[model samples]
Target: MTEKTIFPTRLKNNDYKFTVWAPKARSVRLLAESPKLEITMNKEEFGYWSLIVSGIDAGTRYRYELDGNNSFPDPASLSQPDGVHEASEVIDIHDFEWTDDEWVNIPLDRMIQYELHTGTFSAEGTFEGVIARLDYLKNLGVNTIELLPVAQFSGFRNWGYDGVYPFAVHDGYGGAKELMKLVNTCHQKGIAVILDVVYNHFGPEGNYVSNFGDYFSGKYSTPWGEPLNFDDTNSDEVKNYFLQNALMWCRDFHIDGLRLDAVHAIYDFSAEHIMKQLAGKLDELSQQTEKPYYLIAESNLNDVRYISSHSKGGYGLNGQWSDDFHHAIHALATNETRGYYEDFGTPEQLSKAIKQAFVFDGLYSKYRKKTYGNSTKNNSGEQFVIFSQNHDQVGNRKHGERLISLSSFEMAKLVAGCMFVSPNVPMLFMGEEYGERNPFYYFVSHLDEELNRLVNEGRKEEFKTFFDDKGEAVNPASEEAFERSKLSWGIQKNPEYQSMYNYYKKLIELRKNHPVLQVPDKDKLTITENGKGFTLHRWQGDRQILAFMNFDQNDTELEVPFNQSGNMDKILDSTSTNWNGKGETSPQKIIAGETIKVAKEAILIYSN
Candidate 1:
């Protein structure tokens, strides 16, 4: 039988087949909390323990007792109603009535992802809260929303990366049923859902997976926690455990895609890599359902093997995040050359990132003190997902300052222009479209007081290189930090924020309507670095677009790159009065060989 049929706590007609892999246990017993029952499970091959219990319906709480001594919650639990340390609740995943049979996933290349945290995205801070804003996102022209991890964590407030139960949905977010409703409603609103999943390392608090079996590897170490045992002895069942988790979100909850978090940290040295196996499994699932399902990775190695084809000795993932693109734009916009930003902050670097996919393609870095990253010139732009700001970029800071709060409003518009005009898929952080000024701090509500203190100290130590002052950082364990991170929806009605929202809408409209902008072929794109700025010219046969980006603080004259007799019409100007800019500095019509005065901190788009 396949993993789907063999693994997971399955239920059929009031009968439950409870299965768990505990290689080190001498004996295992099931302790159903409600309706009170105790049964001994038979040990099978491959260290799996199983038993069949009748008359137990959905919502029954249970735990596993090992060696008639210690009891722990199910590792593959579907619901944790009270918390991670409490008993696991049995759920019928197929019980929900879904109406999205005809809804197909949008292609990865055409996605405009808007990432949000479930705890801070709305006032309700539940799955239902996100469903209430689906129409708002659709009207803003975002086709997809990438949610931070929603797996069961330690407490009610968290970023979701500290998830302990891979199969269980966070009880604070309304559990598995509410997540299904969110996905179904999003599809009905013509939006797709991409979930962020952490497979590299488990969180510190309430992690009991290592108690029953060899779930973690002492041979390797990660900054977050103990690395998963992927290449060690008895690794087959370990791989199956995570594989079934990925398929459960797709088969049970109907998620469109998953963004693998920090895959570079997932240590595996087997002959067949874990990522390759995951890609193959997802491909089979997509074929079986006749619906497209995508797997995107987050890696800073700048290696193409993560997104390349299997025939070429690659993992064959659909897409990966481009940190170099974000770094180049961010360093130029903010101009704070601290930490990793030391390697960026130049027009040439930005130009190279826009033309090629990676800025540090086998180049020596002053920060790392060695050469880093392989060239991505051969890869298509569709294989990359670019963003100006994300959860890590904002939350990792000492003060958690967003781009809007860290820079001027004009600079924010300028960066958005650069992102939308590029060939890669663009993503927006939540509240970015409306110029939201909230600080998305790293927060968690761990029950252990010692663990909370350690987290706060670790956060401060991590940012010592970024900030000159040694003052205390915002407390990640405080309730105030989590409350301040919530998005202020009422502020969008203000004049300044309303204008920023409209500007973003216009940029999305242009990207969708223009043929040249829609194409992701970087070969047809040319970027020329000028003084303090650059010129980007992309063409698809007769359809062409020329963008002038000025990052300097003063006006600069730049020569048009078109032919002597060619004429182009201006489509967008970030410095125009309509977008709450100083005024229009660039002309509406452009002739070849003519010099135009581009406003400082502005972006001008022209088409022919």
Candidate 2:
């Protein structure tokens, strides 16, 4: 494969070159719906069919007729104006007028990510809607925004995991041009954009890629279905298709990074895994573009190979989501020991997560009934993206309760402090900074009634272990679920919500300004677990910071674990009266060996 992309329909000088990989088809014809022309395409090498027609340009709708009988949308459609089942529209990707020529990409280590779904982030439910709030995100101290997948799915409402056309932007989300505008506007505002992409399996509905070639394999199975054909026969083209799709986002759409969803489900057994190949190709592109592009993976396997260096016998991706950190904080706060949370819920686990970046490193998990995960002790904290709550952790529940609803406002603040002060990179879900009470329920809209029924039933079955017989799961197919998930921006005016928002803002500012906090080296940090709370001490040369977290129900006094040459001044106290806590209980200054009383469910920071 060359550096040039060969997936989308190429339009040049009033001529459109159509191409499709249909190895099994006896003959393929180009069906131009608008011009009403039927033309046979010449079969090229490697089972590709192509046809070049003049006097045609962008916005023309066309499809491929396989064996001169059945016709389906192009597998590499760039814009599905009429939906996934309709004809694929020709889109000139370079037609947009961009003003981000001087925009520089943010490094992965310094990124403060804010993930939001396009449909629920604003009332318009489109790329333009998100662009309207660029200033709001910038004010919140987020340098990067991670949009949930925008690839064309079945309908207007989806979690974006069900996308069928990887190359096309969703028509409901203002299509390709609007997406380009969003990226361009984000760059102009000094905010980087990372797109979540799904590649484990195509959505059950509106998936026609299999009809073109052997895009799936029956040998390996995922929760959705058979995995993509990565190592099967004739897998080279299949691999190229996805790789080029990734590059198209960077080269054409100017996506800063990608969050690969559930990569543990990607089954491959080749000498050079597809992930390594992708990392190599991305590195080459980064050099050519003179900009750093990151690839972050979402995996629950707790494997360090994804972020490890290639010379270390690993895949060498930029980063991966650290579920152990989320689980540690969530289990401790909610105290709900069901499902995966059963393995967590202790200060010791939280300490391990903060210090080692993985709590289940080669340990036996009661939930899985086996030993899982490798040690990430050698990996830098920059390789992991830590969060207190995300879409899956909140929306997959029966009620989809946020942290404030599930626990308390103080606990929410405490968790936020823990996440920001830790060694790993931090991420915030939409509406979390202000303690939005709206439930982000798992919702979708599929045209097929049978598929919708199955989705509802499957959601119920999946949550049976987490809830008892009395708990009722929300119907994912209902319109109410999707409508209610939208963020209520009006709630930010409330005193309590405003306090929470300010607290998060302060934490982010501290993290950005402090050198000790900015460095993600675990070697310079120490964690000590008390009976009901823990203390974290991070130091670089002469500068040092100490965090005292109390998770108990009542105030408790604990001796300072570290020695101090002089009195340590207080920095941030979550229990301060300004943050709507009960009252300020911590002292203004801390001595070397004195025991200080810490308010329950609060976090205190001190520096010298």
| Residue 217 miss distance in model 1 (angstroms) | 1.1
> All candidates' TM-scores?
0.98, 0.98
- Candidate 2, residues 206-230, lDDT tens digits: the string is 8998888999988989888779998
In candidate 2, position 378 carries an lDDT of: 79
Instruction: Write candidate 1's Cα lDDT for 100-177 as tens digits.
Output: 989999887788999999999999999999999888889889999999999999978899999999888898989999
Q: On a 0 to 100 scale, what is the lDDT of residue 602 in model 2?
A: 87
**TM-score, structure 1 vs. true:** 0.98
lDDT, model 2, position 105: 94
